[model samples]
Target: MFASNPSKRRQMILLVIITFNIISTWLHYTDNALFLSQYPGPEWFTSVGVISAVVVMTPVGLLGYWFYSKGIFWLAYLLLGLYSITSVSSPGHYFFPMVTPISWKMHSLIWLDGIMGVLLIGFLLWSSVVLKEWRSTSVGN
Candidate 1:
């Protein structure tokens, strides 16, 4: 459905961003920290972190599929973009502990997560422009 529109380029970009966000979110919850120091937060906070990640990421996944099927590419892009920003900022509570650990694996995961966050933010900004254009055209017609 996205093949016909000028926004297709942005749609493709957003799709990549959303796919990465979903994968990163899943990996973040599944990966094991090799050291206690690499733990994302206090001992008591890990479960909360997992749950929070699930809550946020699940909707993005679902909405992403909806956008694909309905051709609402801008909405998908916007949601995923917002999701990325929120994921990055909300986890600040845990990021420090996770990265400071002695294990290389944990450090790698932290780096990956940081990259995903940056990509998501970039996609969000680009999607916003596409969304604005879509809105203007829809309203004018």
Candidate 2:
């Protein structure tokens, strides 16, 4: 169960959403790495390179959550926003040519990743608005 307090509830919801976004991103990157042939972007885009990005990005998302849990909203927002940027870019792959025909599996993951990124951004915006209202009321008191 989540707390009834708006701030706590918002934080809890954001945390769950953030975690799901992270997982969705990982799945997308893994799919890209494992099936690089479907992705016809560049010669440099090797499976190793793709997975290495996953290695680097995961920690950033985790750190964002850590900072969020520590009440550091700005840093958390920055880190989380940065982390979500990749997922937001996942759909961009459609703009490029594919070596082989793209399958529904890849398409679904790409959309899911992008949607998760959007959800994270929406939750962050909601959290900010809630925080602003909470601050204003406390300051008035």
Query: Which candidate has the highest lDDT of all?
Result: 2
Please give the lDDT score at residue 54 for candidate 1. Answer: 61
Question: Which whole-number lDDT from 0 to 100 does residue 26 have in model 2?
Answer: 90
Per-candidate TM-score against the hidden true structure: 0.64, 0.86
For residues 17-74, could you state the per-residue lDDT of candidate 1 as single tens digits? 6677667765655563223335656566465566576677668766854664355657
Residue 57's lDDT in candidate 2: 84
Model 2, residue 33: distance off in Å is 0.5
Model 2 alpha-carbon drift over 4 Å, by segment: 129-141
- Distance from true location, Cα of 19 in model 2, Å: 1.6
Error of 2 at 17 (Å): 0.8
- Top-TM-score candidate index: 2
User: Whole-model Cα lDDT per candidate?
Assistant: 0.58, 0.79
